[model samples]
Target: MKVIDLRSDTVTTPTEAMRKAMYDAEVGDDNAHEDPTVNHLEDLVCALLGKEAAILTASGTMSNLVAALAHTNRGDEVIMGSKAHMFWNEAGGVSTLGGVQVQLVPNDKGGRIDPADVEAAIRPDDVHAPRTSLVCLENTHNQCNGSVLTNEDMKAVADVAHAHGLPVHVDGARIFNAAVALEMPAHELCKDVDDVGFCLSKGLSAPVGSMLCGSADFIEEARRWRKIVGGSMRQAGVIAAAGVVAVETMIDRMVEDHAHARRLAEGLSHIPGINVDPDDFQTNIVFVGVDPNTGSTEEFTDRMKEEGVLTAYRGGGRFRLVTHREVGAEDIDTAVDRIAKVASEMRNAR
Candidate 1:
């Protein structure tokens, strides 16, 4: 039996070059800002995102925490979409650690947050209200079926934040996918925002690391927060070597993953018990719902596990299967057959 794992892009294996780079990488203490490879990777990421500087973090969650702590003071508010990765997925680090309030605004299906909602969320000049200091947005929003927030939409929301004297932060974990889908450069997507954190470990296929990027002043603050969070490391360039390879080689190959996602989403639509909208999907992540009357998410997911496919399940009976460097067109075709069979069995049982 062959196993196909479509759970998330996080499941991807590092490229051979990435592995070789890790072995062949130059090393030094990075906590002291002395690792040559890490410095090179940071410079590359800063240029890629068009920011004045960048800091490498251990994970996307750490990247967000660093950004949050840097951009806001205690008891301040960070405005963002309800479905944003930091707001929903992270374990309340900002609120729990920094006393920063997360003011979640409604997210449109297309990954755009309404500018008016942002304006409404900002607090007035009252001593009692928590100051809205930052606005966060996601590129190819995770829960929105990888919907790309357009540059125009981003500028609209950014204008609202800028007018209110709020800095904008973008959780760009899947930003490369957004750039590829739009046929534009990644920096173009980050141009309107004040800062962004793009993951090297996801579609880029690095073994570990994400970059927190912004103006030099902002990065200085984030660096302090990184130290506070214990994200500061020495000789991290060993792993950063893979990250360098990811940025250099992995970005342009993401178009194939997006294509596989489209193919999988189309195939899932043909299964009777699954629910999805092809038009709403734009990147590597696909969300499909199992009919409650037919089967629950656990039942469907567990059954698929038996058939050698895996995915992440969530509330509302939805499951996500993401395509990445490891999962290909043939993998898509095989998973479609497995999913169709599972859906049919569950439908027949009903």
Candidate 2:
């Protein structure tokens, strides 16, 4: 049996081109700003995101942590959507390591925090209130079925943050996905934000690393925080070379992933015991809801695994399936058939 892993885009392996590039990459001490390939990767990200400078980090979590450390002081608060990846998925590193408080504003189904909500969440300049120093957002928000936030959506929140003298940071782990979905440039999507961090390892299919881009001064500060967080690397060009290829070659191809996700969502919707809205299939992530009458999400996932179809059971009667370079249209059909069989068996058993 073939295993169709729909767990996450992070499961993707490096391409042959990426491997070859890694083998041929020039290397030096990246900690001293001397790794030519790492420097080139950073330059590529800066150009793509329209930032003055950028830094490479070990992971998206590290990029967010470094951004938090660089943008806020201890005891300061950062505002973000209730569903922001930093708040839910990053293991509370910002608060634990940086002493920064995370203030949550309600996120709509579309993964947007209302600009008015952001305005209301800002703290007054008072002795008792924790200073609101930063605003954070996620593009193609992971928790919201990979919903893509538009350029205008970003600008509205950024305008409010800037008005309050706060810097804005976007956890753009899948910004290129958002860009492809919107038929816009990634840099344009991030034009109004102060800082943005994007992953090379996710849908981009690089084997490792994420990039944090901003002004040169901010990047200098972030570099210090990167070292503090133990993210400083030496001779990292070997991996960074793949990142260069991911940027240059992998971005435009993401439309295929989006199509596969839509197809998967539509297919799953036909299953009697599965619930999904194909219209909400915006990017590469599809969130499927299991009917309680059929079984719990845990049981559904276990059955799917038994059927050679792997998915992520995101508690609360939901499962998240992500499409990447490895999943094909045929694989989508196979997964749906497997899932349908599982759902039918579970429903009939009930």
Candidate 3:
């Protein structure tokens, strides 16, 4: 049987075009800003994100870390959703390297952080308080079932942050997915924020890399942070060349992935032991709640793996399945069938 991997979009491999671009790319020392291909990729990303400048990083985690380190001072605090990738998935790099504290606002099931809650979370100007230097938003929030934040929602958060003279950074790792879902331009999704970081690896099908885009001065500072974090690369155009193709070709195809996710969610919902809200399905991520009577999350996932389908079990009974460039509609159907069979077996076994 063919294996279907629904684990994450990050598992996507580069395309044939990307491979050719990588092999033919021009190169120079990127640390000196002399790599022509890398420079083009940066310029292209800046144009796409509507920022004055952009810097390429080795990974999305590095992009967020560099942006965080650049936006805030040591001992300052950054406000974001409690379920944010920065707060949960990333290895606490901001607090570890940037010496900043995190203040979290509650995130709704749809991944929206209430602007009022954000305002309340900002610290007052006092001697004893840690200054609230930044506010962060995640568009196409990963942990929140791949919820897409609207431009108005982002602007509302930015309005509150700006009133207090705090900059906003968007952890836009899956931003293109948001843009495609909302039928808006990618840059519009991030226009309200001071800085934005997006992944070229996920959904876009690039082998590796992310971009941090912002004002020229902010990026210059972020470049320093990148160097400090040991992210600066010489002749990085080898990978950046593939990134160029991703930006040019991969974005428009995300709608297919979104549709596949919806189909998967719909199929899983029909199965007896799986609980999923197809209406909550928006982007490429699907969250399914497994019945405790059926099995533990780990047990369900392992059984699915045995059936030649892979998935991730988030804490609690929630299992996450993500659709990407590689997985097609047929694959989603196969995964749903395999998962349902496994869940049914567990229920029968009990």
Candidate 4:
């Protein structure tokens, strides 16, 4: 039986071109700002995001952590949506390592935080209140069925953050996905933000790394935080070379992933016990809801695994399925058929 893994885009491997680039890459000490390939990757990210500079980190979590460290002081607070990857998925590294507090504003179904909510969440300049130093947003929000926040949605929250003298940082791990969905340049999506970090590994299909982009001064500060977090690398050009290829070659192909996800959502919606709104998903991630009368999400996912399909069982009767380069349209159909079988079996057993 063929295994259709819809767990996440992070499972994607580097392409043959990426491997060749890695083999031929020039290497230097990246810690000393001397790795030519890493420097080139950072330059490419800066150009793509319209930022003045960028720093490469080991992962998206590290990029977000470094951004938090660089942008806020100890005891300062950062505001983000309740459904943010920073809030839910990052293991509380910002609070634990950066000595920062996270203030959560409710995210709507589409993964947008109301600008008024952000304005209200800002702390007054008082001795007792934790100073709100930064505001964070996610593009193609992971937990919200990969909902893509528009440029206008971003600017609305950013305007409020700036009014309160706070910097806006975006955990743009899938910004390119959002860009492709909106038919806009990634830089245009990021134009109003103070800083943004995007992943080379997820959807981009690089073997490793994420790039944090901002003003020259901010990125210089981020370098120190990266070192403090033990993310400094030496002779990293070998992997960074793959990142260069990921940027140059892999972005446009993401539209195919998006189409596959939509197909998955539409197919699964036809199943007897599955609930999914095809219109709710805008990128590669699809959220599948299992009817309680049929089975719990755990049971549904377990049955899916038994049928040779892997999915993430999010709590509260939901599963997350992500499509990537490795998952083709045929694979989407296969997964939906497998999932439908499971759902039907569960319903019959009930």
Specify the highest-lDDT model's number: 2
User: What ranking of all candidate models by lDDT puts the best one first?
Assistant: 2, 4, 3, 1
RMSD, one per candidate, in order: 0.9, 0.6, 0.8, 0.7
lDDT of each: 0.90, 0.95, 0.93, 0.94
Candidate 3 lowest-lDDT run of ten: 310-319
Q: After superposition, how far is residue 230 of candidate 2 from its true place, in Å?
A: 0.6
Q: Which lDDT tens digits does candidate 1 get at residues 1-350?
A: 78999988998889899999999999899888899999999999988888999999999999989999998899898999988888878999989988998898999887789999999999998989988899999998998888898888889999999998889999899888999999998888779889989899999999899999999999988988999999999899999999999999989999999899999999888888889777768889999988897789998999999999999846678989899988778889999999899989988887
Error of 4 at 171 (Å): 0.4
Candidate 1, residue 198: the lDDT equals 86
Give the residue spans of candidate 1 off by over 4 A. Answer: none
What C-alpha lDDT does candidate 4 achieve relative to the native structure?
0.94
Off by over 4 Å in 4: none
Off by over 4 Å in 3: none
User: Lowest summed lDDT over 10 consecutive residues: which window, candidate 1?
Assistant: 312-321
**Tens digit of lDDT per residue, candidate 3, span 1-350?**
99999899999999999999999999999999899999999999998999999999999999999999998899999999989999988899999999999999999988999999999999999999999999999989998899999999899999999998999999999999999999999788788889989999999999999999999999999999899999999999998999999999999999999999999989998999879989998999999998998988888888889999988746688989999999988898888889889988999999
What TM-score against the true fold does each predicted structure earn? 0.98, 0.99, 0.99, 0.99
Question: Which residue pairs clash in candidate 4?
Answer: none
After superposition, candidate 2 runs with Cα above 4 Å error: none
In each prediction, how many residue pairs overlap at the backbone (N, C-alpha, C within less than 3 A)?
A: 1, 0, 0, 0
